[model samples]
Target chain A: MTENEINHIFQTWLKQHKALLFKIVRSYAFNEEDRDDLFQEIAIQVWRSVTSFKQQSAVTTWLYRVALNTAIKWTTKERKHQDRHESIDVSQHIIESHQPPDDRLAWLYEEIAQLNEVDRSLTLLLLDGFSYKEMSKILGISESNVGVKINRIKKHLTTKSEKS
Target chain B: MEFKEMKKIWDTQNDEALYVINEDALHRRIKAKKMGTKRKTSFSEVILIVSNLCAGGVVIISHLLKNSGNVAALSMGAMMMIVGAYILFMRSQRIKRDQQTDVSILGDLENAIENINYRIKLSQSMIWFCLIVIAFTMYTVLNSDKSLLNIILISGFFIIGFFMSRWEHKRFNLGKKKQLLDLKEKLINEFEM
Candidate 1:
């Protein structure tokens, strides 16, 4: 594909689906610096994936797969290089003042931060209203496994929220 | 705070711009990242191939200039070139494997594990490469001067190089491999599959 085509496709998808990227980054990365780093990594992966996207699935599904895969790998790599610091020049500011974040959303993210990496991805998919079949396809796990894990995640979140 | 209510809250952010991405900055970064990744992917491979080829070339040229058919120098130079070619081939194969875009997270994880395993194997191969260099150098040195001190110095130099590579293997490759394995285990156990 031409440079212009790739750039156009990437920009269009990114503009349309920035929320999915943001939520995945927030769930995977706790600190602001790490979040930015993870965000950039996911964006880079998504950009690379534009050329390979053959319209096999919806753009959102393809994007979720790319973002989650990048985030999961980044999380693993980050653990090894925890002390290493990176300086990203991009200004991706979280505008909490413009649209005030719900306290429950904040609590939800905190709870998500507590889950294991795979479960964290599953939780995001579950919250985003993906069906067991969709989640299984995205995660490459069995549909039965998705059902079992989603049940546990729901119960855990519900019980935790009741206490909180 | 129930699951349904939580979903309601989560869905609220769908329309709202919770994060403001700098379009210009992001575009520039993306453009730069594209170029950087292309360069970064081949950097190590290029370095290894060039260094080995150059060293081999130098040895062959020096022997030619002296008008001497030194079998050891020629053989060692040929060996180095072969090793360089092997590295070029192996690294390119690995780069291709890593670039495969598997849409599933499980496939990505398996690819990641394979990538790290390849790295660990590459580092081990470097040790074997060092041994070849050391053996060739020792043979040439003994042929020229059967001196214990000279032998010790040459062996010491390669020994230090060997240890440095081993240190790097333990410090980076092993740590990354362990983390990837742990991640894979966590995912497998989570899925109960």
Candidate 2:
């Protein structure tokens, strides 16, 4: 594909699905600096994956796969060298919305932060109403495994909410 | 709240974007990042390849210039060239393998492990190769009609190099090995569930 075509497609994806990428970034990275770094990494991955997208799967699913893969790797790599390297300057490139925060959404993100990397991803997919089949495809796991994990994640979140 | 209620909360943000992107800056950043990544890789890998080849050439030329007919120096030069060629080959294969990895989480994890393992093995090979080169270089230096002070300084340089390489391996390669093992465990455990 031509550079112009790729850039245009990337711009379209950003306009339509920036929130989805933000959700993954927030779930994986807690600090503002880390979030910025992860957001850039995921965006870059999404841009790279555009040429490979064959329309065989939904665009959202493909974006999820790219974002999640990049976020997971970024999480691992970040832990190894936290605060050691300079961060990407994302302050001007991307900024959070000024909308008021919802307590429940904050609570949900906190709970997600408590889970393992895989569980965190599963939580996002489950909450967003993705099918087990879609989650399995993005995660490269069996459908049954996705089902089992979703069940456990639901139970964990429910049990935590009851305690609160 | 039940799962349904929680899903409702999550869905509320589906239409409300959380972050705003500066389209022009993002475009510029992506372009610069792409170029920077290419330049970084070329600078590191290409420099290593060229320097190794150049070091080998210099060694061979110096020996020929002095008419020393030093077989040890000649063999060391050849070994350096071989190591450089090996690195060139391995780097190409690594790039090819990297391009083939999909965006799936499992695939990324597997690729990470493979890349780390390759690095660990390469570091091991490099350490051994350095040792051999140091030994042969020392032998050549000693047998040459050099002053006592010169021999000691050259030997001292190699010894310091030996320690530095070991230190680097311990500092970096061991951490990478641990990361590889942890990733392997994560992959296996995720699948076992």
Candidate 3:
């Protein structure tokens, strides 16, 4: 109820859920520097918005809402100035860094990178074991829509994997 | 493996190995008011709107004082400010619309895809505005001085500018629109709808 209580609670949530920030950021940003920047941006947003949080939704759901909004807004701006990224294959970066050892995870990331911004967010939430109802609440969509979309998305990806 | 299985895998890959989330560092960054990432779109938009307003203010003030009859400057300034305001409004509205989805992934996809369309619209309108400004300015110049050579040269320049804008649309914005469309379709297909 008190401001300090809300602040303390939010800080704890943020600290414990640092990985939430990372998962959301990686879906939006292209490189290490961009990821760091997005993470900072999301953190600032959380800091500002957490006090106003009504506690109507789960803290993680609310956090995802804020993070996704920031990422979507940031991506729209970045898209205008970024060079043709396809021109530069990511294999070089893959070589240059400690890579994702799991090929399935790696493939998942690649597929996610190709997705539209919102789909990417939904997929991230889905992969994090969010229920359809929870995703619906955060995304402002219906439960059945989430279920149908998730089913379709899974079928789509699996079909792609099979064809390849 | 199933997608659920993949998610299970994703949940397991913790960030402890590399860059840990430094709460102290985040607090410092938040306190410093450096919330933005490296890109400066908001900053630049503010700069753009301010500059346009100043330019418009100067032109309108000068015209009122009758320093010169260059009404083109007033129109250009006014038009640019309108465009800037429209862009700023759209962006703010998108950000402020609360949640795009809470019940469905389809809602999220639709909102996201719609945002891309909005962007394409922004770029298209900007191009048209520039062309209209150029056309109006040239007409004003022609009306002020009616000479054959001037007409010929001005028409030539206008034609060149017209073509140049078309080229720009093809070279830049059209390609972007196509990409967005493809992505939208991909999302649609992802849901098998």
Candidate 4:
């Protein structure tokens, strides 16, 4: 496909599923700058990979896989040189406040950020309404494993929220 | 709450906070792919120059020492072998680092570090091997006289390169270890909070 055609498809995907990309980036980035960097990196990667995008899976599934993978890598890389920046406090970005979190949905996101990397990806895919088969394809896991993990994540989130 | 109720809440959650990409800017960036092209071109140029210098130097030294018989040939062969090995090792390391950067998953960090450590060891060994080769070359050039001055120079360079590489490897390992520790701490704090 031509670059223009790829750009058109990407624009449509971005408009429809931008929130998913944003949330994944936010969860993985240490700060706003890191989020923006990851956003650009993911966009570049998606653009590069779009030519090979077969319609075997939904666009949302492909996008989530790319975005999550990008964020995870970004976090891992950043963690190495993070000590150099003594002034940039990570705690500032942690969502902890008493403003009711703008509703339980915001609180849900705050909690999602607390999950481990694999669990966070699984939970985010579940929230995005991916079927077990789709989750399996995106995560390279078995459908049965997806079902088991999702059930465990649900219980874990409940206990976590109740304690809070 | 049960899974069903949790799903219900998740279904009803607002997702307006998600930021979508600006397609126009992205298109512009795609159109301006010159930077990547330039980087590749410059990288290839450097590799070409270094390879030429290494090969040319080996050829000239081999020819000059031609009258010295098999020992000179062996020294020349060993030098070329060292250079070829260094080039191959560096190329492999570059490819590995690129691949590591392309994929982003937490589980890959350890593998990346292991690759880095392997590269460091290869580099250290390369330095020592080159030093030994240089010492042999000097001894051959001096007709096995083993000049003290040449030995000092060869040993000095070897010691310096050895210590420098050793320091670099230590620093890299320390940095990687600290990063893993920080990641562990972050995960704990996030879950605990």
Best by lDDT: 2
Q: What's the DockQ of model 1? A: 0.26
| DockQ for candidate 2, C-alpha atoms | 0.29
lDDT (Cα, tens digit) per residue for candidate 4, span A1-164: 76457667766776676666676775676555466556666765565567778988878888887887666666678453323322333323222112223456666778888877878888888877789999888876778877888888988888877886
Give Cα distance to truth, residue B109, candidate 3, Å.
32
Question: At residue A63, what lDDT does model 1 achieve?
Answer: 95
DockQ of each: 0.26, 0.29, 0.13, 0.13
lDDT of 1 by residue, A1-164 (tens): 88568767877887788888888988988776577667767776787788899998888888999999878889877362222233335455331224585788899999999998899999999888888888898988899988888898999999999998
Q: Model 2 Cα displacement at A94 (Å)?
A: 2.1
lDDT of 3: 0.63
| Best-to-worst lDDT order | 2, 1, 3, 4
Q: Highest DockQ: give the candidate number.
A: 2
Per-residue CA lDDT of candidate 2, range B78-149, in tens?
888888888999889978986886544334433554665676676677779888988898888788789999
Q: Residue-wise lDDT of candidate 3 within B110-151, one digit each (tens)?
A: 344355455456546656765786776676667675688887
- lDDT tens digits, residue span B45-101, model 1: 687789888999888888889876879978898888888899899887877776773
Compute the lDDT of residue B92 as modeled in candidate 4: 64
Model 1 misses residue A164 by how many Å?
A: 2.5
When superposed on Cα atoms, how far off is each prediction in RMSD?
Answer: 7.5, 7.8, 11.4, 10.0
What's each prediction's TM-score?
0.68, 0.66, 0.49, 0.54
Q: Which runs in model 4 stand beyond 4 Å of their true positions?
A: A78-101, B1-193
- Please give, as one word, the docking class of candidate 2: acceptable
